[model samples]
Target: MIILYNLVLLVMRAGYNIAALFHNKARAFVTGRKDVFTKLGDYFRQNHAKVVWVHCASLGEFEQGRPLIESIKKEYPQTKILLTFFSPSGYEVRKNYDQADFIGYLPWDSAANAERFISIVKPTLAVFVKYEFWHHYAKALKQHQIPLLSVSSIFREEQMFFKPYGGFYRGILKNFSYFFVQNETSLHLLKSIGIDACAVAGDTRFDRVYAIVKQGGEIPVARQFKSDQKTFVVGSCWPEDFEVLTPLINENRIKFIIAPHEITETFMAAMESSLQVKSVRFSQAAGKPLEDYQVLIIDNIGMLSRLYRYGEFAFIGGAYGKGLHNILEAACYGVPIFFGNKDYEKYQEAVDLINRGGAFEVRDYTDLKAKYEMLNSPETFLLACEVTRLYVEENLGATEKIMHYCRTLLA
Candidate 1:
């Protein structure tokens, strides 16, 4: 199984290199790791400080781990932090994150790379967020007697660890010193598999979103566009999302703030063409009367999370195609949420929200229209708002729980 896994990784590396010829993100993934070891060695050698390393697979996992990272920095100001990502999306966006003392891409998961990386960084404590379960890295950390924690993790019965021929994968779980999982199902699943160093800590993303709500930021364009009217926020929208939403947007009953996942010129132009209502790009909104446009298209990144503050309702994208974007960002603002009815079961929050009536899942344009009308009722909308708010508040403190365990390890 180990050999097979290594072979698969090698094949993936080759495929990514080939895909880099035409794919921007693939190019980034390939080029970003060109001198990763040299960069890691240079930084670590210059600073012989006690380091805590946090590894996140992508941006989503980074959000789940961010509260813990910030908490560690605040509590142990002298301890240096090393943050690594496997995906370019995570590293590229957060490369200049000031909190982490060092940021780099994690070398591909191989025994030699793992041994070399563990020796170079010498992290006193290593934290893997959410779905990061690198086999060789976990083994290397255990051999070095370092405390490795898996935080905000969730397990399902269908995962390889619970399969009949999953002995090797189950061994990887044993390498972790402790697991701070998201729910009772995950806790019970681990115990069933004979892995007991775990507890239900909920999800750290709740803490992250709550913090965002408190430290409010200003977006004058979004505020002006939303003034004196109900606004629907469409965050992380892809073409699939737009296919179902274009009709509703054309109706122009309320204001809209559409922030697409990819802010490419072509996609933005297409999106604008699809809408019959008057619209303006965020970049082009300067000096123009924002209230004059029915649609305000965000032509940049980093503002979608904060834009939720100006929304009465939200439709998060990605479930129609791949995975869903972070719905909690809008939910924390007490906004009624909606999304495509696919690829969402893995996200426990989405499932919980649907069950609690805090969120709705629509199959297509008709489904979306019906659900929207149902929620339009004042009593129903207000109830959903309260549900979402309370859900976020109740899930608070996962980061603190995980931090208590981290304190013991760092001490």
Candidate 2:
């Protein structure tokens, strides 16, 4: 079965490479590290304890693992960081982030490719962020007696590891030295697979968000919204997400910062048409002063998380789709959160805050209006912000937890 899986992955790699040519992102990977996975085995052979491998499927996972990676770097400054991506989205956006010693793509998870890649990187420890489990890579790491750890792991029922016939991937779970999950539900899900080395680290993201907030929240963007008061930031947005709520946003009761999910021109134009307020485009604002606009459209990427600092509350994007953006990013500043309903299983933090009344979910315009009305009540908004602040203060120590464990292990 494993060999068959390996063969299947091998066939997929060739197809994926061909597929990469059509996608600028995938094309970037081939260009970014022409010899990355190709030279992995050789690199691994040369470096043993000096290397630590961190794998993220894309930018979201990269942010989830950022604090943990920073902690690891601080704890072991001399240890080199080997970061790998399986997607172009993450690689293209953050390929130049200074933390990693090396940034590149992982060849497909075929047996020969996985083994060869592992042999070259020669990671003393491999950290897989979120729930990205590559079967052959898991097996290869275990076969070589390398330590594997999963950080910020959130398990949904649909994942193969939790299915009734998931024993195959459960074997992969056993290779990990630890499973640092986001919540108790994920812990239970892992236990369902008979995987016990788990801890409710409460999402390394809380640590990341907390640090981001305290670290001078959002660099100077050189402009402000034309709001005297009551400004709302709609972050990581999709049109379906704004379908019912755009009317209220256009109602002029509040200001807006709609950072659409896609940076395409079509989406930006559609967003501008949806708003009644004088909507200003972010790209167009490059040469103009931004102080007079009530509605600012952030057409660029990398600014959503930072932009939260300028708002009273921010509606995170992704809930209208399969999932949502990181609520903790806004929550770190005690910013009240509102989102659509779909990312419930993946967003454990959202569920927790919603239950705690720190956040709310909107199904349509009515829900948005209700949440908006509540926000109008300064007392209610303050209470929500209080809940968010307390939640952040209480869970800001995940970095210490991982660091403590690493101290004992690396000693």
TM per candidate:
0.90, 0.84
* Cα RMSD to the true fold for all candidates: 2.5, 3.5
For candidate 2, write residues 145-214 as lDDT tens digits. Answer: 8888888888877887777787777887887889888778889988877888898886677777777667
Candidate 1, clashing residue pairs?
none
- Tens digits of lDDT, candidate 1, 352-372: 999999999999999999999
Backbone collision tally, model 1: 0
Which numbered prediction scores highest in TM-score against the true structure?
A: 1
RMSD, candidate 2, Å = 3.5
